[model samples]
Target: MDQEDPGFSAVGEVAGDRVTVRVSGEVDMATADAMFRAATPGRVRAATLDLRAVTFFDSAAIHTLVRLADHYPGALKVFPSDRVRRVLDISGLGHQPWVSADQG
Candidate 1:
């Protein structure tokens, strides 16, 4: 599924048991839910969130990511942009096993 807002977009690609959702633009209260929904479609063994293009991320975005991490457990991986990384670091979530600067 693909979701688009004025300054945000989330597009998902599925391969076998894994779903990779690429998110761009600003992620705030207005777009976080949509991003979460787009990231998780039905049931998948694993999920990858690519937020390297996200220019802005807020608390709502963080909450959405946390929810997704919980939903996918150890199967969730997040590739964060520098902007998102700063927020995640400040929020103490950047050190999470799910979060990685490397694309892998």
Candidate 2:
């Protein structure tokens, strides 16, 4: 599934029990909900969030990611862009086990 709106885009790929959601552009209050919906569709056992292309990430985006991480618990992984990483680091979630600069 893929959705695009102005400065934001979210693309989701499902493989068996895992879902990978790649998001780009500005992710703020306006697009946070849509990003959440894209990441959590149906009963996915695991989720990978790829935000390497995100140029801007806000608190709402962080909240959305937190919700998704909580929903999937240890099964959630995140690959963040430099901008997103700075925010996550400031917000104290950058060093979490689920968050990594490497896709692997």
In model 1, residue pairs whose N, Cα or C atoms come closer than 3 Å (at least 3 residues apart or on different chains), thus clashing, are none
Residue-wise C-alpha lDDT for candidate 1, range 25-74, written one tens digit per residue: 99988899988888888767899999999999999999999999899989
35-99: candidate 2 lDDT, tens digit per residue: 89999989789999999999999899999988988899899999999899999999999998889
Off by over 4 Å in 1: 1-4
Name the candidate that leads on TM-score: 1
TM-score of each: 0.92, 0.91
Candidate 1 contains a number of clashing pairs equal to 0
The number of the candidate with the highest lDDT is 1
Whole-model Cα lDDT of every candidate shown, in order? 0.90, 0.90
lDDT of 2 at 78: 92
